[model samples]
Target: MSNLVEVKNLCVDYITFDGPIRAVTDVNFNIKKGEILGLAGESGCGKSTIAFSLMRLHRPPALISEGKIEFEGKNVLEMSDSELRKYRWQGASMVFQSAMNCLNPVKTIEYQFWDVFDAHDMVSNREESIKKAKELLRIVDIPEDRLFDYPHQFSGGMRQRVVIAMALALKPKLLIMDEPTTALDVVVQREILQKVYQLKEQFGFSILFITHDLSLMVEFCDRIGIMYSGQLVELAPAKEILQSPYHPYSDGLGNSFPTLIGDLQEMRGIPGTPLDLSKVPPGCRFAPRCHLAKETCHIKPPHIHQQNECRLVACHYPINTSDNRDQLPIKLTQVAEV
Candidate 1:
């Protein structure tokens, strides 16, 4: 399938009082038409920053210093204000993290649904818009009668469903969901995602799914990309990433989530905080915490190697997995690759 969105060498930076802090560095990836691609990493990993750049929504202090975010080969960063209005909803729509919080408390759900159409200049008249709103609510499995209630009247899950329904009203080509289920309870999260998965299958929309939940991503995403220190360190099929992660950061993440049927185990976190972008070193950013650090790792960053179809990794010592036993900061750089 052809690429629906392509981000090449994308870098986002923030000018702090201290200096320029690089948040995303040399990021590159593409989402194909009708595919679900997951961006998996811990918090503060620039996953959200990439989403903002794609929509050209970064505020002051945060800037897309370089690189291109191309939506169907058109540069998003170069779009005009009017162009952006058309770009946002018609081309790519986002279901943001805690999106329900952005809902207007006083506005009835029905009124808010019309606003989305109004912003895009879609519906022709009030009656037509309300009819459309009712249809959308039904599509999201929300009751049409609940449309007259205020946002505050709905539960978190219902509010989230409303937001997602609004995003789908325009039938956007690419849907960017940043931790879409973060606030919902586990069962609700599953229900909402199951609905989303079903909708994607029916409507044929590509999705950029971002979350720290690796296991969920594995189940939902056809392909997965692992981000580390603002860079995409690995991109592979979901099963490949889970079974044979390459980058040390990706490997560490795999270790953090245990299987459901396995012995009940305590979940562990990756040791060492991500690098401070302002003071980022010249060499591999993960070397400080990597167990397989070598003279080469400290001297320069590694290039991505395409080991197989849809499997690419940036790591100097990806094959070594010997140090898995090291506690807390488990360094698997020495462990033999299975």
Candidate 2:
């Protein structure tokens, strides 16, 4: 499949009183058309930073220090204001992490849905807007008449569904969802995600789902990218990641989640805290916490290299219990030939 979006050497920094703090560094990935890509990592690991950057939604303090966000061969970073406005909802739309709070408490759902239609000039007639709004509500399994109700009148899960409907209003080619299932129960989360998957099939839009929930990502997404301390440590198929994680951080994340089919076992978390972005070390970002780290890992940064045809890892020594563990630093060429 062709790529819907491609992000190259993306770096995002936050300007502070002291200096620039690296929130995201040298991140590169692409979302295939009609594919579901999930970004998983601990909090403050720049998962959301990448998401916001994709839509050019980063604010003043957060700057896109270095990067190229290309969608359909067009550079988003260099787009004009008029072009950006048209590109946002029509090309890509986002369902923010705080979906419930995104809605205005005082505004009726109909008016809120109309806002997107008006902003994008998608619908001029009120009757058309209402018709579209009702169709969206019905698609999300909500009663069409409920669009007239205030946000406060609906439950959190219903509000989230509303947000999802709003995001799909313009039939964006890519939908970036940042923790849309957060603060909701498991049942609700499953329902919302299942609905999203169904919609993706119906609308044929690619998805960039951001969340810390690795287990959830494994089940929902086609590919999973694991980030640590603002850098992508591993990118592979979701099941491949779940079955055999190459990077240490990815392994730690895999162990952190409970498995449904397994016996009850203690969850193991990575040993140390994440690196301080302000005083980032010279080498691998996860070296400070990685159990498999050697002297070379802490002294020099590891470049992203492919292990197999489909897997990419950024680690001098990827986690391996087999004979490869004693092979010192792995050579990418040899691994790719395996």
Candidate 3:
């Protein structure tokens, strides 16, 4: 498939009296048309920062330092206010991390849906908008009778579904979902994601799914990009990463989650705390925590290279070496065969 969005050399910084604190640096990736591309990492790894940049939602403190955000061949950074106003909801939309935060507490659910129509001049007739609103609500499994109810009247899961309904209100070509199901129960989370995956197939829109759960992402997304200290350390097919990860950090992240079919084992999360943005170390950002790091890893930055036609990694000593290559792949293959 062709690319729907291309983000190249992206760097986002937060300005302070001292200097710009780089939150996300040198990130590059593309979301293919009708594909679900996921960004996975521990908290504060710049996944949200990159999402905000795509929407130009950064406030005064946060700024895009250097990058090109190209969406559908148009430069997002260069769009005028009017163009952006039209582009945002119609071309692309986002379901923010919190559903409660996304909805206005004082406004009725119908008004929340109508407000979007008002902003883009999508509809002037209230009855027609109401009809459309009911359809959207139904898609997310919300009752049409609840359309006039306030946000607080609904449960957390219902509110999240409402937000999902709003994000798809415009039939946007791309949808950015940032931690969309974090606040919900596991069953609700799975149900909502199933609804979204069904909607993706029905509407044919691409998705940028951001989350910390590598296991969940691997199941939901077409490809997974693992982030560390604001940098993209690895990108590969979801199953490939699960079967045999290339980066040490990616391997470590895979080990953090458990498998239902396997014998219970201790979850070995990546060792050490995340890097402090204010005082970032030189060379490879993940070198301090990576057990495979050699002398060169601490002295010079590892260059991002294509590990295969479909995989990319930024590591001096990737785990997929000749000596140990395909070890996990064979195990996973056997599991699948069983």
Output the number of the TM-score-best candidate.
3
TM-score per candidate, in order? 0.92, 0.94, 0.95
Q: Please give, for residues 242-320, the per-residue lDDT of candidate 1 as tens digits.
A: 6667677887887786665545556666677878776777788889888767899998988777856768888777753
lDDT of 2 by residue, 40-72 (tens): 999999999998899899899999999899999
Clashes of 3: 0
Per-candidate Cα lDDT values, in order, are: 0.84, 0.88, 0.88
Residues 1-338 of candidate 3 have per-residue lDDT tens digits of 89999999999999999999999989999999999999999999999999999999999999999989999999999999998987798889999989999899999999988988877788888897899899999998898999999999999989988998999999999999999998688898888899999999999999999999877887799999999989999999988887788888888887776776766666676779999989887889999997777899988998778988999999887876676565333233212321
The TM-score measured for candidate 1 stands at 0.92
Runs in model 3 deviating more than 4 A are 323-338
| C-alpha positional error of residue 12 in candidate 3 after TM-score superposition, expressed in Å | 0.7
